[model samples]
Each structure stands twice: as C-alpha cells, then as structure tokens.
Target: MPASPSAKIRANVPIPLSEKAIATRFVSFSGLNDDKEHIAIIYGSPEQQEAPLIRIHSECLTGDVFGSQRCDCGEQLHEAQRIMSAEGGVLLYLRQEGRGIGLYNKLDAYALQDTGVDTYTANEMLGFAHDQRDFTPAIDMLKALGLKRIRLLSNNPHKADDLVKAGIEVTERVQTGVYVNQYNAEYLKAKVDQQDHSITLKQN
Candidate 1:
C-alpha cells in the first residue's frame, strides 16, 4: 500500500462553500505522454485505507465547465461533488475527454450526432469505440491513495465493472443524479438504450 504518491501534490487551502468549508488537494500524475495532464481531487480525507466514495469522472469541457445541456455530464459531475462533499471521498477527474477521443474529435462526433444520430453510433462513425476510456489511471490513483476498495459513484455500469477489472473492490455502487433537459432527453434515452446506463427518466 502506498502511503504517499510519487505524483506532485498541492493543497488548496480554504475551499469554502455556501454551507460548509473544506480543503481540496490536487495530485498531478507525473510523466504522461498524453497531451492532457490528469490529476486527482481529494474532497475530504477518509479515516483509513477503507472503502470510500469515488467518482471516476471523465473530463467534459462543454457540459462540466460550460454547463451545456447537450448531455448530462455537468449535472452528474456537480451531483457527484455534492455527494462526496458530505460523505467524504476522492474524485478522479480523468483527462479522457470526449470518451478518450480528444476534444475536437468529440466535437466532430457532436456534429454527427446533430444529424439525427445517437451518441454511440457517432463515435463508431468516427472509428472509435462507444467509450474509448480506460480506467487504469483511476486505479493507479486509488492505489497511491492507499485505498483498495471503493463505493463507486456512477450510473454507467461499465465504470464499476472497469474498476473491478482493474483489481479494485467495488463495495458499493452509487447512482449519481440524472438531469434530463430538452436538449439532452434523446441523448439520455440513447444512453440507457445503447450504453446500458442505469438512468431512470420520466417516460413519455
């Protein structure tokens, strides 16, 4: 078990919220050939090397940062943060943007999607997997944090499966919030239909 990670660590003092105050720590994974530098954000410290809440959030520039309603990424990210804030856990913000197809490639897929296509097929049309993301970075971060078990937070069943496959014990699976908007209703439905996401939306 790694007590301390070899990655660069920086402390963000006094991360204040409307209802609470917490400390945020950013751990930068070193020596990556990928153009994007990935990091792990620890919300609240866990008591010991035990199973804690973890959200392996892939980067979503449009939805997460810009609050785009084209998908539910922003809503899910915020919901995961709020939950982990109260319960205590780590959020591994992976740099696997656009499901590991890069940002511009994702943007191109978005254009294809606008042409009456779904999310999954759009990626295929671009010669990529439905989700090209790999959870190895997340597994490494958890191991570095001295955690072998986790209560994974996600609606995508494949996330937990991937963690388990990476030799981490998923003690519990927490379903993050689902935000259904006019712009992303079809997208959400397509996820449930094709991606096997466990999202419960109001049926029409």
Candidate 2:
C-alpha cells in the first residue's frame, strides 16, 4: 500500500435514499488524487462503535447506477447497504470506475471481452494492468473517519491486505453475497480464478 495524502472531511450532509428508505450521511473528502469527488455513505454512527463494518467499494457507473448485469458491482453495493443499514457501518465509495482504468477504456475493454477475451485479458490487451485500483485513498478515508480498526465487508482479499499494510487493523473479513447471473457467470469465475476473490459459484 502506497502512502497517500491525508484526507479531511470536505462536506457532510444527511440524505435519505428513497428506494432503500435509509437515512445516510453523505460525506465527501478532500486531498485525494484526481480531484474526483469520492463519497462515504455512512449508514450509522460508526464513530461510536468499537469496530464498525466497512466496505471500500469502487465506483461502477454501468453496474451501480444503471444496474448492468455484466458484473456484480450493483448487487454487491446494495447488499452492503442492506447489511450496514441494520448493523452500523461505513461504505467508502471510491471513484475508481472500471477498476481505475477509467470509463471509456473500460468500454473498450468490454468490446474486447465480447471477442472472447476475459476481463483481465481485455485490460492487458489495452496495456492496462489486471486491476489498477489504488487502495491508498481508501486508507486515507478510513483514517479521516478516525477508524483504526474495522470489520471489512468484502470478498476481495487484496482490500484486507492493503488496509493491514497501511496499519489499519482489519478485525474480520466478511464476504458479500455472491450474485451469479447468466451474464456475469464468466466474470465472477474470472474473479475467483484469476484474482482469488472468495466466492462460491453454483456448479451446473
């Protein structure tokens, strides 16, 4: 984990999500790379808890906002919200679209995927790494929230490894729900096979 610049709370506002019927605290941060507005959707009073549940979710415009079935990002985001809303947690929504390769490049990679290449291979064909997401911003966000330790809600082991390297103690690793659809079955399998994401898929 590389050292990132320290972040501070830029703004905090209470916004009620109509679909989930959950009142969340929308927090934005300052002093990050790219000057993009990453958000921290706070479900409960994590500052009051010993080890709050945390999910460092990367942005997925197609999947998260438009509900694209090509990936499980949207499902995972909602699942995190459902659990955190009840159990008290912080969802750090990092603006790392397309695993940090940017949106247009991601679409180009998608075109390559349509030609029978896996996601990682498509990225490689475009001269990008398999996963370019930098977790330093996530560390900065966590530190800004005054969280020294947390129960990480994710299936990605890299997240835990990065946090630990940055001196943030991950108390527990909780797996998110495995959302397998016909459109994303290959994508999900690639995650488990290539990246070692902790997921169990149905054997057909």
Candidate 3:
C-alpha cells in the first residue's frame, strides 16, 4: 500500500544564513502531511501585484549540503536564489530526499550508479519509481501564503503540470540551467533521457 499522507514528516530547520547583498527574507516551515522540512527565501516585495516567481526544489543532501557534484542540485539552488533575488520571487526548498525515497535508499542508489547503472535503473533496482515525489504540499503551502499564481522556475514540465492540476495557476516557466562538468555529465543525461527533464546544457 502507498504510504498515508500523514506518514510524511515535517520539521522547521534554519538555512545557513546568507549575508550577500541581495534583498532576501528567510522563512522555514514543516509540511505535516508530507513530513518534509521546508525553507524558503522570499525575494522582492511581497506586495507586488505581479505573479510571484517560485521554485519548489526538493532537498538533495549529498548535492546541496555536501557539495557533491554528481548532480546539479546545488548549482540549480544557487541559481534560483540569484534569479529570485534579482527579479523577486520565492524559493521553496522541500525536503524530499532522493525524490521521496529517503536518505539511506538514495545513498544505496548512488552506490548502484557508481557501478555503471544509470539513475533510473538504479532506482528501479531499489524498488522505486523514477521520481516518487508529489507536489501537493507545495500547492497547499502556496495557497497558505496567499499566492494565487506564479511564474515557476524549473526545467521539469511535470512540476508545472502538477501545480496547475492542483489549481495553482502557472503563468510561465523560467529555465534554470547549469554547466555540465565531468562529474555530472552522465547524471544530467539520465535526467534528460530517463526522466524527460527539460534541461538546456551550457554550450562550450
């Protein structure tokens, strides 16, 4: 059986505070239904009538926290903050590790990937879907914040689809791209090929 909605855990965690010269406001909350800790950096004036730009990024402890280069999570996050700070929007950092498979299993999948398996194949071997995350909590949180619509920042079409389906009007999709290095080339390809993520690689 699928896990119950309440089985998901949530916690309030502080992000490493930033002192950069950007207009940013930090907020943290937990998703009780999904049990995910969430941190947000709100940029721009919330009173602006324009549709707020938002990014619902799932937590990647290895990549975001540990500076692992096997994937572009950390880079994408930094890019999100940079853009949002400049343009005005919100960065919703969701704590769904490994696309909701949790930490230990994600590490296990990493070991499998190191042995020549791609990310999709590794997740399958570990009895998981290619992406097990759901965006319902994001929708709820946006509503709670009184955001009626947003220009979403993402390369994944499904994120737009999911938010729209959940009644959050997505006005536009803002692309977030990063350079592909030797460490994350295969991983990025797996995202494009297997997950059908719409990522544009930086041209040499």
- The candidate scoring highest on lDDT is 2
Model 1 whole-model lDDT (C-alpha atoms): 0.79
Model 2 TM-score on a 0 to 1 scale: 0.95
- Which residue ranges in model 2 land beyond 4 Å of their true spot? 18-22
Model 1, 65-97: lDDT tens digits are: 999989999998888778777777788898888
Q: Relative to the unseen true structure, what is the Cα RMSD of model 1?
A: 3.5
Better candidate number, 2 or 3, judged by lDDT? 2
Overall lDDT per candidate, in order of appearance: 0.79, 0.90, 0.77
Question: 75-173 in candidate 2: lDDT tens per residue?
Answer: 999999888877779999999999999999999999999999999999999999999999888888889889989999999999999899899999999
The worst-scoring run of ten residues by lDDT in candidate 3 lies at: 1-10
Number of the candidate with higher TM-score, 2 or 3: 2
Candidate 1 vs 3: which has more TM-score: 1
- TM-score for each predicted model, relative to the true structure: 0.87, 0.95, 0.85
Candidate 3: where are CA atoms >4 Å away? 1-20, 28-31, 201-204
| Candidate 3 positional error at 169, Å | 1.0
